[model samples]
Structures are given as structure tokens and as C-alpha cells.
Target chain A: MGNVAYAVLSSDEQEVSIMEKKIQWETELVHALQRSKVEKRPILLDFHNPH
Target chain B: MDTVTYPQQSVVTFIEHNLIPLRVGSDTQPLASDFAVTWTPTLVLLDPQGKEHHRTVGFFDAEALIPSLLLGLGKVEYDSNKFKEALGYLEKLLAEYPESDSAPEAIFLTGVNRYKSTGNPLPLKEAYEQLQRMYPASTWTKRAYPYRLLG
Candidate 1:
């Protein structure tokens, strides 16, 4: 697969993130998205999440 | 500006080349103001219409930028606990690495995130105050005045 750069845009944090691959970014993105759902708005990404 | 493209090469080489997708201007003022990009190495996420979606300024590496990017994309929602986790790290960066170029911006950004996600004005106020007190001359401070933390 071609190298994919995954970018996530969060409104609450007003921040953007990019990772080298979709798998890597998506894995982390899911955790963060779920957290955002819980928190009731978008928050900063926990970029260091191991999963 | 209408479309986005990523020219994939060796990641390390691409990092070396620093080929950002957006067409950045030579002058720092516009980028800093319109997009909230206050630091040199910023990753700005523009909407398809080219409006600012979210921006990560001065993150040292992808590790620091990716999660923030996810948040910007609307793929992630807010989590107070998670925000706290990120805030902890940012605070650590400030306390442990005061000399780091990204420290001040991190503080301000964290405050911005806190406000947006949790509607907490106090931390955002602290962030503005921090820049004013410690780095009064910081570019972020210049942009901070109009921001009234309280509704």
C-alpha cells in the first residue's frame, strides 16, 4: 500500500494530527474519538496512547 | 488549496524535505493570525474549502501531532480524563523543559483545548496569563488579547 498520512481535525482542541500510516493513526484515533464522545466535545488527542 | 495531496517518499527523507501539503506563505504574520499557528513547525489542517479546521504548532514529531490531528478531524470527541492526560504531559513539558521552544505554545494550546472541550475558562485564562507573564513578547501573546476566556 502507498504510504498514507492520516490527519485528524478536532474542533474543541483546534488541533490537527498526522501519522505515517492509516493503521497507526486509526488505531489511535478510535481511542481519542471515543474519549471525545465521552467528554461531550472534542478534546486534544492523547497522542501517546499505546493502542 | 482546493485539494490536498501527500507525495509519499521515505518518511525520513520526507521529513528532511519538509514538503508540507498546504502552500504556506513566506510571512509568518498571516499564518499566525488566521490559522492560530504561532510556532515555526506547525501542522495546519484546513477544511476542504481552505478554512482553518485545526492546527498543531511546534509539535516536535509525528508522535506529538497525530492524536491532535485526529481530534481536529472530528473523528474523536472530548474526554475530560483524556484531556487531563494530555494536559499532564503538557504541564510536564512546561515544568521539565521550560527551555523547549514548544513549551509556551503547548501551554496556550492546552488551554485552548480545555476551553473548547470542557467549557472551562479558568485554564484558558491561566494559559493567556502564562504567556503574558512569562513570554509577554511571544507571538501567541499578541494573538491572545482579544480572547476573553469567560463568556
Candidate 2:
């Protein structure tokens, strides 16, 4: 989960929140990809609901 | 999936801690004057000699962003018409996801395309100002100012 690099250039804490969300999304993406690989199906990625 | 390269190697140096390229510097100083520095992410495009090319500040959706970065880096043949079409898709995405992380950039691109198409500048200024007011602390606001007010 922490392996992916989160890149940002802002000092605002709000941006940090964004990064957190991005990280969560990336984690979900990886999980979904893993599941898809096991199931042998293409996974759909949606921003609204990662689960 | 296409590969593109700049005349020179460009870098997206993440200024914030914990981000990729994890670099640190004085908060008081400009990160790159010689290379085009985009904010919120500070993506820099450089010439062969490492001179500034173009800068953008804000997060871009896959539609508008992927192409814009490719064109800026001289990675592929960019058709302005194709980019305009892509901007339409980005605008719709913003309308659907107004609070998405990429919203501000979509707003900026809308105004930018409008201004470019009609030369009104009013829409562009208004859009840029919206970003400034909404995301006051955003580093992107700094770049939007000169374009919104002066040019």
C-alpha cells in the first residue's frame, strides 16, 4: 500500500488530504487488479467507489 | 500507449514531503526559473539546454492532461483540434464530479479553451479567479494570476 509514490508540490494541508485519498484509491486499484488477475477478468476502475 | 520525449529531459520534482522525487528546498524561493514549473505538482518541461518551455498548475484528468503533457514535452504530434475535443470530455467530467481532485484543473481548462476560442478573456479570468478564491493556498493560484489579470 505504501509502495506507490505519491507526488505533490503544494504546502497546503488540503493537498495532503488529497494525497491520502489518492493513496487509498491506488491501494484499492491494486487490490482490484489482483482480484481481477485471480478471476481472469478485466476490472473496471471507478473513482466514486473503489470497492 | 505511446512514448514521448522532450527535447531535453524534463522532471516532475515533487516539492512536498513523502511525494515521489522527494526533494526539499527553501519555501521562500522559486523551485525552477530555468525550467517551466507547474504548480500543485510543479511539473517542469525543459528545452535541450534546460530552459523553460511551458508550465501548468493543477491536477489534470486523464483526458486533457495526458495529451497536454505529451504535447508540452514534444513527445507526440499534438493536434489542437483533438485537444479541444478532449477538453470537452474534461469539462463534462468536472460537471459530474465537481469536487473531484481534478475539478480545479477542469475549470481552468474550460476557461482557457473558451478564451482561446473566442478571445473574450472574461471567461478565462472568471474561471481563474474562481480557482484563486476557492483554492487560495494552492500554488497553482500564483500562475493563474498573471494569466488572469495581466495576460
Clash numbers, per candidate: 15, 0
Q: Chain B TM-score, candidate 1? A: 0.45
Query: What TM-score goes with each of the models?
Result: 0.36, 0.35
DockQ of each: 0.03, 0.02
Q: For residues B20-107, could you state the per-residue lDDT of candidate 1 as single tens digits?
A: 2333432444434655444445554433233444555443443333334433443121232356555655665566556555556666
- Winning model by DockQ: 1
Candidate 2 Cα errors over 4 Å, as ranges: A1-51, B1-79, B82-84, B148-151
Q: What is the Å distance of residue B66 in model 1 from its true position?
A: 15
Where is the poorest 10-residue window by lDDT in model 2 chain A? A42-51
Q: lDDT of each model, Cα atoms only?
A: 0.47, 0.43
